[model samples]
Target: MAALISTTDTEAQSSGDPSSKRGGWITFPFLMATLLGLSITSFGWVMNLIVFLIEEYNIKNIAAAQISNIVNGCFSMLPVVTAILADSFFGNIPVISASAFISFLGIFLLTLITSFDYLRPKPCETGSILCQSPSKLQLGILYAALALVTTGTAGTRVTLASAGANQYEKPKDKGSFFNWYFLTVNTGAIISATAIVYTQDNASWKLGFGICAAANLISFFVFISGKRYYKHDKPMKSPFTSLVRVVVAATVKRKAVISSKEEDYHHNELIEEAMPSKSFRFLNRAALKVEGDLKLSGDDSFNNIWRLCSVQEVEDFKAVLRLIPLWLAIMLVSTPIVVQASMMILQGLVTDRGLGPHFKVPAGSLQVITIISACIVIIINNWLVYPMYQKLTNKPLTPLQKVGIGQVFTILSMAISAVVESKRLKTVGNEHPMSVLWLFPPLVIVGIGEAFQLPANTELFYGEFPESLRNTATSLTSVVIGISFYLSTALIDVIQRTTAWLPDDINHGRVDNVYWVLVIGGVLNLGYFLVCCWLYKYRNLKNDDQEQDP
Candidate 1:
């Protein structure tokens, strides 16, 4: 998604009018408003979905968690596909508009499902022997609603982020926009996780989903209203084809000796003076000039794309390759968090949720703590921590350093979760259960980690990739998150099948052991991330003050 914005800016600059009236801070308010509405709508339904499945659809606790993970996986993964559509066929406006409408329809359907009794299974107590599973027809309708919601939400998430950032030309302003972007998002999540989830738990699911539907509909209109203020970019030919050509050209010329002379390599007008970097020298063959590689017309264009590529194209592909290790490490760091999100709900259900005699905390609302924590952390980082660090060190925190801090917090969160779960297991049979507050420490830590990692990752990827490939770079984080959620689902399934540690009833299972495993994995992932950071060379350094290593 970040890539889409960069592509738009690059196109604007190439057109010799970088200061066009189509984009600037003037568009900021509208984009932020649209994002806020969408955020409220998205989180309103998603945060409580596990509970919805368990209570309305009569799903098993573990099955509901797995379903929740799969849904989240889709939420993260679909952005990549939609981003391509925005970049290749439809521009961001059409894609975002259509997606928001689709999201409204999905949420509206969910509202209908909650209103009608026949649309879901008969209500039953959690873990009851007489609880009935949803019939095939009911399940089908439910799944259809979920599918629409997932697709619609996925399309809008990253697209909106990209669109918002596209309004600003300067990198510093872009960075500030991201900070506020996430703050707005987390603020909306806080509303949904508290107000919306509370409505569902205490008032009526129909009304709660109705609110979500209205928010989505309103957000669609809000986005449409701002259409005139946006800096719209025309859809470009898919950049991926050129990347593939580079790989193909390199393979075809594998036996060709790599050239040191700049004249022997093909260079586009934009980079005529640029020579191939010494690293990955074999890939330089892709740009090496050979007899018959050029067309007889004497134009710069190659006769065969599979046999020859420009130097820029080769380097673009190499940039992607270099990012792979860090990408995997970050993905691994996120997987445990995915696991924790689902598992926390299960833990909350068994714990004492009574805030007072008048009110009880909803299990789903436990996630709000993490959201609030992340929001607070973001505020502190922006106002105090970052300024203080720069004052003392004479440099702002680099994205890689922020990511490393996130990894450390991730490990800490997992260890804390393990300790909390172990203590909770011991008090399982007590007349008074453990307070739900016990879950707060780990959840808050997870939020803090998110505050550091997610934005830093976006900044890192957006800054490092080639301008031609920038459209794909930001979407890489979404891909990582999507894969992480799927991997979390797989891990849970594997645990359930092979070990007694995760039985149907969590009260009798060893969830602490699961957290311990995640803790170990988090440590290993941190080490791997550090190594990647050390080895990586920044291709698009924003400033000399930024450090090269984490």
Candidate 2:
């Protein structure tokens, strides 16, 4: 580790020389450009997807939302697999570049679907009693496009963050890069949600999808062009494999007596000597250097499986075990957020979207309110709220505390959503359309909750997890989102089949009841979260102070 740090410092010093080939800020633009182009391409289709399904394909609104949820879930989840591949096999640049090409192909195929007639179902005649559903062939083509796009977006999204952070050795520069990365992401989202949605709604689907395809194509090349300037990390075997190995080895040697002496464990020469934590004592058997477990006198002749492991390996596995409950609790927190996002689009469809006499807002674009609010809140919280709190209290709010505050806001948002939805239902009678602005308060509240929870949740994982599992740690947020989305899909399906609350036509159904369910669920989940927070101890409490660096 010292040698690695020395090399990085040397590279940093040499970066000032005009002739140096590596290590500087020159790669930032390339990453930003790649991110911007990809975000535009991904969000262009995703944000407006429900509208497209309802308008062009004539699918039921509820079904369309479910499909969107599934796609979003896939989009979120695929990053886990990709991040693992980057960290354990292929590394970041290759995975990102390959994903970019896949994305381009996906969007390009979508453009083709829009430009051609046979690729999609025939347009339903106005006020037709029986609209023609898309054929199996058409559905197959569409799903293929969605799969490629989801996989592509997932691969590139988080991997780029890792790649960018690798360029800088200092924590401060890395933190600053992350801030700008998120800002670029939001910027791309706003543009795609507004401009691209408007183009698809008012102009032509072909043109809009074409623009997305073109952007993706450009992004692929942009990333490849910067390959020479970027710093690259070599892929190594995943720590997850070692964790699993420890479990298997410990179980095989269950009858073996554990040892109290430090010398009884196989300590890696490179790592400093330390006793294993007593919390998960059973796993300590995995590291016990019993007779025949090692060949200390020989070269490359030691038990590799079902026998022994290094002391560090056992503790790493235990750290992961400790985090599982907290991870599961947070999954519940995200489920309602996913459910609300899916439902909000449907609500916007029914609400009066007119801004004035001449302008009307697109239903799909309503999410921009949430996006804009979250960005603003993130800025304000970091720049004003946190500092002020620290000044007043003489100590900063811990990550867990921040997340707990987020839980409160989440509960409030759900309650607010339920009330607003009830009001909208009441006003929908007598041909009265509730103003779309009614959706803003809940969305803004949820956004504030995100600002609090997301950073804390991310920091907790990154700070607490084993160093070898850093890639996996950062990707955990994506995993939660993915699982929550799938859970939300299942929840919506159960609601549709088991209750009258979520019919195809929400006007005839009790949509407000669903929000009430979320409110109750949010409260329960918040309770679960608080309990987890109480039980959880930070593995690196001092390291967390560095996490606050700007």
Best by TM-score: 2
Per-residue lDDT of 365-391 in model 2, one digit per residue for the tens? 988888898888888998999999999
RMSD of each: 4.6, 4.7
How close to the true structure is residue 10 of candidate 1, measured as C-alpha lDDT?
62
TM per prediction: 0.92, 0.93
Score each candidate by Cα lDDT: 0.87, 0.87
User: lDDT tens string, model 1, 1-550?
Assistant: 5456666666666797757556788778888888888899889998999999988888999999999999989998999899989988898889999999998889999999999999988888666588878999998988899899889989988788788788888899988898788778888898999999999999999999999899888888888886766887689888798988888888888889887788998878776548888878888988998876766555555467777888888888888889889888999999999999999999999999998899889999999998888878977998999899999998788889999998899889999999999999999889999999999999999999998998799888989888876877788888889999899999999999988888868999999999999999988888888888888878766675454785
Q: Clash number for every model?
A: 2, 0
Number of residue pairs clashing in candidate 2, backbone atoms closer than 3 angstroms, sequence gap of 3 or more or interchain: 0
* Residue 162 lDDT, candidate 2, scale 0-100: 93
Q: Ten-residue segment with the worst summed lDDT in candidate 1?
A: 294-303
lDDT of 1 at 395: 79
Candidate number with greatest lDDT: 1
